[model samples]
Target: MQFTIIKYEIIVVSFVALLIFLLIGIAYLTLLERKFMASIQRRRGPNVVGIFGLLQPIADGVKLIVKETILPSHSNTLVYVLAPIFTFFCSLVLWLVLPFGQGHALYDFPLGLLYILAISSLSIYGIIFSGWSSNSKYAFLGGLRSAAQMISYELSMGLVLLCVILVSGSFHLGSIIESQVYSFHSVTLFPIWIIFIVCILAETNRAPFDLPEAEAELVAGYNVEYSSLAFALFFLGEYANILFMSALSTILFLGGYLPIIELIPLPGILWFTVKCLLHALIFIWVRATFPRFRYDQLMKLGWKYLLPLSLSFLLVESSILIIINPY
Candidate 1:
């Protein structure tokens, strides 16, 4: 009984630590995205808050907290109150299965990958509820778009993940990383690695796949009616989901916590962070460089292009393994 209590306490403490890290990362990611986008557009971004806008996120947080939470006259009061909370909680829960470094994961569940996919799929509900409960046309349209887009892309993303499971032969994230680690004489498997990165970007709703929040059509999508701290929660959840997806990509494809070159002797966590940041940077870069697709184009690309490609990759990988073993 005493040991169980200690274990529970440890788990709680670890979850709290992870929450802090995620919140900090989300704040900095907003700053970093603005900074990067500013440089690309030949302008300064957020320079006044602190040294080169280092404290800008904190200032923004304070402002949001102090602002009024205005409830719309026609809104469903109960769901209006609950939508952002649900969205924030869903995003936060994803970190439980994410492995940060060697022996650093919260739980080593055998079905970790499937568990993450399930949680992510469920997060769309929060967006739907927020939009519908707001009782505004813009909000309703935004919510409908988000639900359709997420469902469409999620299918392709799942197919891509199915390919990874085929190649690695396990749903455990740590095992997937171990499969990617280089041995003495064999050549590294590069094909699976490439597919994993592409899938991660799509799964996270990064551009060229950000149809859910396309400003041209939905005017900020499902959270259109949110303001002040309520809006902040949605913003935080979106960026946190980005970070979580990037971290998951690092773990599954780029060899989580493993050094890229293997010659350098850096710590595992350092490698993991660097890899995640690079992935995040790529996401931002795509947003800056590419234009959003038409809704039909986006749906076509996922269903027609990515799905079949992922399935073929799985088939080819299976054939290679059979020929190599022949028994």
Candidate 2:
């Protein structure tokens, strides 16, 4: 009983530490985006807060917390308040099964990949509920768009994961990582990697695929009615999901927690983080480089193009797997 109590206490402490680390990561990711986009546009970024705007995220957090939270009189107050909380909660919980390195994950669930997919699907509900509860047409339309967009792209995403699982023969994230020891899937399955990247961009509501939150059409999308800390929660959740997807991409393709050179003495966790950061930087770069896709075009690309491509790859992967390991 004493040992069990100590284990539970350790789990709680580790979770709290991870929560702080993740929140810090999300905050700096926003700063990184702003700085990166500024350089791309040849404009000065947030240089007023701290050295090179290091403290900008902190300032923004304080401002949001202290500002008045405006509640829409006609909105369903309970759901209105709950939506962003739920969204942020879902985003944070995804880290539970993420393996930072060999023997380094918080909880090494055998079905970690499936858990990630399941939790990602649940993230859509927060958006839908926020839009419906807001009692606004624009927000409602935005929510509907997000629902359709996520659902459509998720099919392709799932197919892509199926291909990976077929190749690795295990749903466990760590086992999947270990399978890439000899050769990274990014090199072998380059086309699938490309499709996965596109799917994740849409999944995280990033630019080009950000049709649901299109400023011109949906105003501010499903979170249009939110302000102050409510708005901040949505902001944090969006970035958190982006980072999560980036980390997932690293695990899937870049050889999670693996060093590029066998001679290098770097820690696996550091290598994993470096790979994830590169992917995250790619996210920001794509935002700077591409124009937003029109809603119809986005849907057509996902359903018409990506879905078929992913399905084909999945079928090929499965056939090859069966041939190689026939019982």
Candidate 3:
């Protein structure tokens, strides 16, 4: 009984630590993205708050908290209030099963990947509910678009994940990372890596796939009616989801926390962070470089292009593996 109490206490502490780390990362990621985007556009980012704008996110948080929240006259107040909370909670929940490095996850489950997929898909409900509950045409349209986009891309994303499961022979994220640990001549395979990157981008609604929140069309999409701290929650949740997807990609594909060359003695978490930043930078670069996709084009690419490609890749991988290791 004493040991069980100690185990429960440890679990609770670890969960709290994970939440702190995720919240801090979300805060800083906003600053990093703004800085990168400003440099890309040849402008100074947030340099006023502190040296190099290090305190900008903290200042923004304070401002949001102090600002008044405006609830629409005809809004469904209960859902309007709960939507962002749900979105934020769903985004954070996936971290519980995500392995940052070998044996460094908060929790491990046999179906960790599927659990992530399920949580990601459910996050759309928060967006849809927010839009519908806001009682505004713009919000309704944004919610509809978001739901469609998420549903369309999710199919391809699931197919792509299946390829990783096939390669690793396990749905547990820890086991997937373990499979990627290899010697000099035995590097991680390439095809699964490609699929993983593409899926992560689509899953996070990154540029070239950010149809739901196309500012020109949706005026900020599902969270159009949100203001002050309420809006901040949605913003934080979106960026956190982006970071989570990037980290998941790094873990599943590029070998989470495992150095590319393996000669470096850096901590595994350092490698994990570096890889995640690289992925996040690629997302920013794409946003800066590419135009947003039209809704139709976005749906077509997900269903016609990514879906078929991932399915075919899965089939080819299975066939090759069967031929090589027939029992």
lDDT of each: 0.81, 0.93, 0.83
Q: What TM-score does candidate 1 get on C-alpha atoms?
A: 0.94
Higher-TM-score candidate among 1 and 3? 3
The CA root-mean-square deviation of candidate 1, after full C-alpha superposition on the true structure, stands at 2.3
**TM-score of predicted model 2?**
0.98
Off by over 4 Å in 3: 183-192
Lowest lDDT sum, 10 consecutive residues, model 1, at: 183-192
Error of 2 at 48 (Å): 1.5
**Residue 219, candidate 3: alpha-carbon lDDT:** 84
Model 1 CA deviation exceeding 4 Å by range: 183-199
Best by lDDT: 2
lDDT of model number 1: 0.81
Over the full model, what C-alpha lDDT does candidate 2 score relative to the true structure? 0.93
Question: What TM-score does structure 3 among the candidates reach?
Answer: 0.95
| Per-residue lDDT of model 3, residues 119-165, tens digit only | 99899999988999999888999888888877877887787778778
The C-alpha RMSD in Å for every predicted model, in order, reads 2.3, 0.9, 1.9
| Residue-level lDDT tens digits of model 1 in 164-243 | 67667899988887787773101244565555555556555667776667778778777778899889988888888889
Q: What's the CA error at residue 262 for candidate 2, in Å? A: 1.5
